[model samples]
Target chain A: MAESKKPDSSRRSERSRRAIYEAALALVGETGYARTTIEGIAARAGVGKQTIYRWWPSKAAVLLEAFLDVAEQAAQGEPLIPDTGDLEADLKLVMRATVDELNSPPYDAPARALAAESVVDPGLAAEFVGRLLEPQLQLYVHRLRSAQDAGHVRAGVDPRIALELLVGPLAHRWLLRTLPLTHAYADEVVEYALYGLAPRP
Target chain B: MAESKKPDSSRRSERSRRAIYEAALALVGETGYARTTIEGIAARAGVGKQTIYRWWPSKAAVLLEAFLDVAEQAAQGEPLIPDTGDLEADLKLVMRATVDELNSPPYDAPARALAAESVVDPGLAAEFVGRLLEPQLQLYVHRLRSAQDAGHVRAGVDPRIALELLVGPLAHRWLLRTLPLTHAYADEVVEYALYGLAPRP
Candidate 1:
């Protein structure tokens, strides 16, 4: 519902929710996941502890929702993967965007914090993959399925697994810091993934 | 370096070093990288805190050495990747072994701990990647270079980047727990990476 149409209380609630999200993201980025607490987030956001607890079950839940909000704001209603009947260009565009997003401080710090926590916490990891990551991955799956229909990708390719070939290298580089994550690296990943590493006959 | 030539004091020092390594690994696995401390490791290993400090400058250093020890034990002096004159087979063999290692508790728990820490700690991540991971990855570089010489791989391909296509997916799956990492999955990654996702003419 639009804020103008909503009651004053509902509008206030929306403002509070956004505040909470901002607080959570900022706190996690500054302090790291292990030290970020509900009380701390509440104090930072100028909201009551009960207000946060009523909305989210745990610190993880709050942080995850906060991350989702950040990602949505970053997306700004853009279609995640554009389909222009050219699979390579489409994938490269998305991958380049991803490279930019990863490099951006607003996304990178909080994401690294969440990812670090997820490695040790299976429950959080499951919720993260299910709630945030899988849905985003599904967009690629859909795009790849369209590619298969267009005879761009092979018929036998599993979209889920195939998508990883594109995303996995970027993630590996970003997480491990093995090398610089640049637009050039992103383009290389797309090209390498689409074409075989072996001598193409 | 043989124990037979060592004096009594040297032998005792060797035993204490082994104890310290075991204690560091077990502590990191049981608690986590953040909680695992020099004092805790020393207490667990039945050694003085000074002994740990004397040997390693920090917990990260100690844990890294411990990890190297575990990896050495796991390898059992076997070459990390065997060049059996079949690049695909060799890659698959190593990937499958990696799948098993990631699945195994002894390697998995401590590795997850170290990896989690590395995400937030750039210094540790650099050391982990440089001292431990890069050396292992270099084996693949060597194998791929050999393949290039044998006319199996494309001459233009950079083996370092090319190797990520194979290793990245497995690391992504293992770390994220997005899907079950298996020998079958490893084989598919090998096949898809070699042959590409697009159909051959």
Candidate 2:
């Protein structure tokens, strides 16, 4: 599954793309969203401005794709969202992966930088939610709906809101630095959420 | 109780401080965190750079105090944290008030600007979290502890982590633009959090 690529030209294109993505991530991590520009990215990547513009429409688009590439790599080329038969285990595994991603230096800095920038910039925020966050969230939506069909989750629950119960706490903890974002914390969130925080007989 | 007991010169200092605070907020809202500076605030408020420096150490400090003052006012002269005997009702009240403030023009724009700026800048973020976010969160911690005492929340529930269930969804919505933040949403978070999302008899 990993070796589905073609010949020499594709290899060069892949190399350029990887370089550009790394440069974009590093620049944003170093200089922030406002100061990281297309020109600067191209300069850092050893590509012309038109090279980047040909592939992506804007800096936001480039950065968004760069982040996706990073996430894809970190997932060990695993699909961005997985659908193992067990919904709770599947969700917990993904959330734990996310906690790991959010803690690691490369993913942590750039993602937080972009997310923080998006908090205020509505245009950038719209792009972020549309391209980056929502698609990933929709994977969970699909998973939860499947869970409902299988009777794992309550059929009455809004999958979107239900999904937030799982993801929101992690996102909240990561963004705010409120506490340690550990596998244990991720597992507890899953446990507390699936069983409910209230006492069970 | 709103009245000050300081002498004439100190009262003059108080007035200038208020003006500086107002100026800082307005400037940050208008131009965002990056563009806001002591010189602009001073110029807008018709105070000297020395005047701002005499009172606060940095632009972030000025903005922090400005936001704190606004929070204090929006609180309508109430305690920073409300502690009614009923825990759920008190939290619901505070979260609803938060929704109102987040939706209000007076608080929304400036707060968004500062929060966005803090995302990339660690120094600024630390200051923002320490001064503004943590103090407010402590109120909930105190209230939740009180609830633990009353046996409303589970005895083993960590107040800080538990409070996130209450605060996280709201913040997630507000920060991520995932949903319309409203009074209804606040009440829903309170319910979903205190009870569990799973089926309950």
- Which window of 10 residues has the lowest lDDT sum in candidate 2 chain B? B192-201
For all predicted structures, in order, the TM-scores are 0.98, 0.92
DockQ of each: 0.82, 0.56
Residue runs of model 1 more than 4 Å from their true location after superposition: none
Please provide, for model 1 over B90-170, each residue's C-alpha lDDT reduced to its tens digit, 9 standing for 90 to 100.
999999999999999989999999998999889999999999999999999999999999988988888998899989999
Q: What are the chain A TM-scores for all the models, listed individually?
A: 0.97, 0.90
lDDT of 2 by residue, A167-194 (tens): 8889888887766899988877776677
Native contacts retained, all candidates in order:
0.71, 0.43
Docking class of 2: medium
Cα deviation of A124 in candidate 1 (Å)?
0.5
Say what the RMSD of model 1 is: 1.3
Show where candidate 2 strays beyond 4 Å. Answer: A1-8, A79-87, B1-6, B80-85
Expressed as tens digits, the lDDT of each residue in B1-201 for candidate 2 is 445666788888888889998998998988889999899999998889999998888899999999998988887878755777777788789899889888888787799888877766768878988888988888888988887787777777777777777777888888878778989878777766776655554
Q: Would candidate 1 be rated incorrect, acceptable, medium or high by CAPRI criteria?
A: high
